[model samples]
Target: MTLYETIFVRRSVRKYDKTPLDDETLRGIQKILDEAERIDGQTGRFEIVVGSRVKNATAPHYIFAFSEANDGAYANVGYVLQKVDLYLQSIGVGSVWLGAGKPVESAPDYVIMLAFGKTEVPLRSGAQDFRRLVLGEISDGDNAVAQAARLAPSAANSQPWKLHFEDGKVTVRYFGRGLLKAMLKKMNKVDIGIVLRHIEIALLKEGKTVRSVTATAAAGGGDLTAEITYVD
Candidate 1:
């Protein structure tokens, strides 16, 4: 299926069949990851691992995607990981960003995990049924991805992100206020990543491919930024 088709067809699949990713499918996943890393250079700042165990016991049959902390440096791990999630969906795989779970001891800095497998039952809803808002529909141009991003789940639904669009690039700014910042900083970029995932899904639906996506540290009072540049 085309990227847009996958976006429209994809859903947050939780339950999975016993089937694991075949070698061919795993190679395909690697290709997608490679492309995502190429498009977004932040891939080098972290690592991606695969495992059968779900960090949370309640959700077994899950695959893992983890990232190491870079001394709390440019915290765009979430943005990068979310790109991984959307790319997986585009290639006929299902994944859910696993936010709440037991941290792997070997990888304490690893912020997020993704559950993966074949769906036992298809999701009933279509992508069109999924929310995608237009520029004019929003209260401010700076909130380009607000509605769609809001749909992105955060730890306990804190929704700690503010987005801005300028120079044809969508900039995701973190709202690092309240008690949630210090507590959720480890996984905060993960939420931005999920929002970036939603934006990419919307762009693909519009028949455009994201040429590049980048995350940078907040300077002069800005939080992390996720910039999406489109293909012609």
Candidate 2:
């Protein structure tokens, strides 16, 4: 299936089966990780780490991902990781973002962990519905983006983003109020990128195209913006 198709079918999978990852699936994931690293480059500033755990240790099997904590970067990490997660799902691998209870740890200044594996539990009932938001009913243009932005995951799903729209551009502001505010700012960038990804996906599904995404801090006090222009 295509990447967008994967995006549509992918859901957060929390429970796992006892089955182990096959050689082919492992190779495919490795290849994608390599390509993602190259595409992300130094400008994007993120990394994906894959590891395995003993059965019953936590999840039967998993892949852990992290990136250096820098301003406006976590959002990008989320964006990139979402794509990686989608690709994994396309191959019949189950995955979910590991939250507070998982045994994952962070380095001194790093954003850590996305759990991937095969699940025994049936897919969650409302998982697909969770991705939906009302675009037509959004009165504040920026909030429309923010509504979508809220869906973008952050460290522990903290969601520390605020958006404002002006003229033809959308501005994304970082609130930086969480405990790890500095780390959150970097993660927020990847989150912004994830938000951008959702905005483009939603628009394309509606037969619209985004013209551009430019970053600006017009809202002041560390607020970051992504000005999106629509295609006529």
Candidate 3:
């Protein structure tokens, strides 16, 4: 299935077979990580290592993301890695986002990691398999984009984002939640990026071409926002 179709069936796979992937498969995944797009004005780095290099070995491989600490950077990491997550599953590999995971030799800029390997788990049947907020709660309208984007995973399922659609673009704003404001703020930023990818794919599936994607900080340091413009 294409990445767009994979989104509906994908799930966070925690139990993976311990066998390492072939060198060719690992290299192909590395290439995907290297070429994945980022949120504008953000610079993030990625690395693929064996499970032995990570603190928990749920999977045989882990892709670690590193970037400067900030909303845009964190969001960029999510935007890029979510593509890898979808692609891995599209090709029969299983993956899951690891927020609490750490590398044995950590970089100061590390943001998050994705654990992936072969698995026995099955993909979800379709959109019905996802347990998420209704479209009205997360977006302004029940368009196809909102439907697909709502399924994007968040830290602890916080889903802290609000989407505003306009003539030629959609603006994603960070909507903070939970008692731990400090921690949720960071993960929610990543969630914003993940949803952005879903929005882009949904738009493309609707026969729209993305013109540009830009990220910016709200005035007075309020919401962190990313705007995506497209042409029909």
Each candidate: RMSD = 4.6, 5.3, 1.2
| Worst lDDT 10-window in candidate 3 | 177-186
Tens digit of per-residue lDDT, candidate 3, span 37-125: 77877779888888999986789999889888888888998899999999999999999998888788878888889999999999999
User: Model 1: per-residue lDDT, tens digit, 98-177?
Assistant: 66755444454455566666665464255345544443432146332444554564655566666676545666666654
Q: Is candidate 1 or candidate 3 better by lDDT?
A: 3
Instruction: Flag regions of model 1 displaced more than 4 Å.
Output: 38-41, 44-76, 90-92, 103-105, 127-139, 142-153, 176-182, 200-212, 220-222, 229-232
Where in model 3 is the C-alpha error above 4 Å? none
RMSD of 1: 4.6
Runs in model 2 with CA error above 4 Å?
A: 5-9, 37-57, 99-106, 121-128, 131-171, 175-190, 202-221, 227-232
lDDT of 2 at 108: 57
Best-performing candidate as measured by lDDT: 3
- Per-model clash counts, in order, read 4, 24, 0
Residue-level lDDT tens digits of model 2 in 161-183: 55555555555555555577765
- In model 3, pairs of residues that clash are none
Best by TM-score: 3
> Ranking under TM-score, best-scoring first?
3, 1, 2
